[model samples]
Target: MNKKPNVAIVGATGMVGHAFLKVLEERNFPVKDIRLLASGRSKGKKIKFCGNDFKVEELVKGSFKDIDIALFSAGAAISKEFAPLAVKAGAVVVDNSSAFRMDPGVPLVVPEVNPKAIQRHKGIIANPNCSTIQMVVVLKPLHDAARIKRIVVSSYQSASGWGKEAVDQLWAETEQIIKSRIQHPGSSIKVDGVKKVLPAQIAFNVIPQIDVFLPNRYTKEEMKMVNETRKIMEDDSIKITATCVRVGVFISHAEAVNIETEKKLTPEEATEILRHSAGVEVIDDISKEKYPLPIDAAGKDASFVGRIRADESVENGLNLWIVSDNLRKGAALNAVQIAELLIK
Candidate 1:
């Protein structure tokens, strides 16, 4: 424990994987060495970490032989296959996937919310879904203060949440739309390029479906919020529902969250509590036309919250507008923070 850990980053070339490297360097996480592991297609690819370049190695069964921490952001399938192997090899895994999130043993975590849960990890710590991560960070303080009973959240997630391909498709389709508008003069263009990354057009519109539809008609992404929030808070009785939408933005995620608490808290009171909450930034100044936005939170670590008000429909309800860089605090930064907590 005295020495710096040898870290292995699985999926080192993907969007979240790339962010992991940036967050590690920015936070100055003590690292004895870094091993960049990716798919065969990415093998021998050079990636920069801590101001130096490192070669990406093809991830194999024995890749975690001497690794201390394996930060996984590869998709669920990859994580399902490799994470257990990494754990078997004595490397603690911080997985960013839906694979093990709900498993009773896997402690789903957002460092700002339930950090003590880190000590309970059997071997793998599941990083909660990006949308869930931001919402829970904002909720932790309020929930603690007023005791949240029910939560309804709608997320305007960015294309970057899907990874590099979705971001590329968004811009590519946007460029095509502008070109078509200019060339054809008053004609609309179909978002053909975006369909591959998302089921519907994402350039000028928002797609309400994220992940596949479940038997309950709620999409998987929505259910992740419902389940992950309960798990992280260690309160299964808390009622929660979510609707996740994919927007054309390239970074950050924005959510409108309404909470019904046991005790009443005014907008001013709610704002004061969030101002002192860890990893939360309040930007509610309507006079200046100020509030949290996706672009405002891009590349930042804090969850930006604003639009604090009371939900008039319910007696003890309060509302919030939460925004954050999904890739940073919502994904990579949270994983790295867990690694930091692990060694401490």
Candidate 2:
């Protein structure tokens, strides 16, 4: 590997793709060259990186040639087709889609949790789902201290998790609601004629579903948290369940995670453990009104944890509040961290 790798970003025009460039530049990743690839629709679009303008190129069979690392944020279909091509072209792929995550051959990675898994990559590494990434980073250290027996997590995800259109939909819905209030003053405000990217109206509302529901009644997003958490933690015996909700916030994702551990850990003990853990920030001073908030976590890399307390109903149960920028630590930054591991 060169001291400065030649990198290519798939889906370079999407939200997470743009984040890839931002995180890479912020970290000063050593990149000898960068190729931005997207679908035909985004071709020739200009994106600025490191003070230089780069043209987005249409992704094709030959796009990965001479690329040392390919960071893929395109959807699963695109990754399923092109990731292998990137591998065949001798570029190691760090895919940020669900395409290869469950594949036993691919390491479902969150750098703060299972970084050594990156060593087993068979030409590609899978970044776990955004929600899974943040949760696991906070849980891993505690899991080590007092083996996690079962986990129940409810996520308050942001609009950006669905991509750019969903965010636009949120903004448009809010504007419409505000305008209706100003005009009618007392009538029930109704949002109309906005392109529906989410399953329900997201302004001032929360949707319990994220991805489509499976026969088991869990949405794919929820199941991803359940399945990926076990895989990344390397503990298939652990019981895990999740309810993923799409909230109106535009940036960070927050989770209320309750865990039953094999051994007891008090709130104070848990706080001390997480404080020293990598990629985790402890912000729990409740009396002073300090805790992890999505707005405060936006654009930050750390997984913030607060509200640590014992779940007294059950023995050895603990609860935690976790928050992180869904686009950064949850997606692009995690991918970039994997690439950094590759070079080392």
Which candidate comes out best when scored by TM-score? 2
- Give the number of colliding residue pairs in candidate 2: 0
Q: What is the number of residue pairs that collide in model 1?
A: 0
Candidate 1 TM-score, true structure as reference: 0.96
Model 2 C-alpha lDDT per residue in residues 1-344, reported as the tens digit of each score: 56689999998999999899999999999999999999999989999999999999999999998999999998999999999999999999999999999999999888888888888989999999999999999999999999999999999999999999899889988898787655443443445666788898788888999989999999999999999999999999999989999999999999999999999999899999999999999999999989999999999999999999999999899999999999999999999999999998
lDDT of 2 at 35: 100
User: What's every prediction's RMSD, in angstroms?
Assistant: 2.0, 2.0
Residue 317, model 1: Cα distance from true site in angstroms: 1.0
- The reply for model 2, stretches above 4 Å from the true place, is 182-194
lDDT of 1 at 125: 96
Tens digits of per-residue lDDT, candidate 1, 293-324, equal: 89879999999999999899989999899999
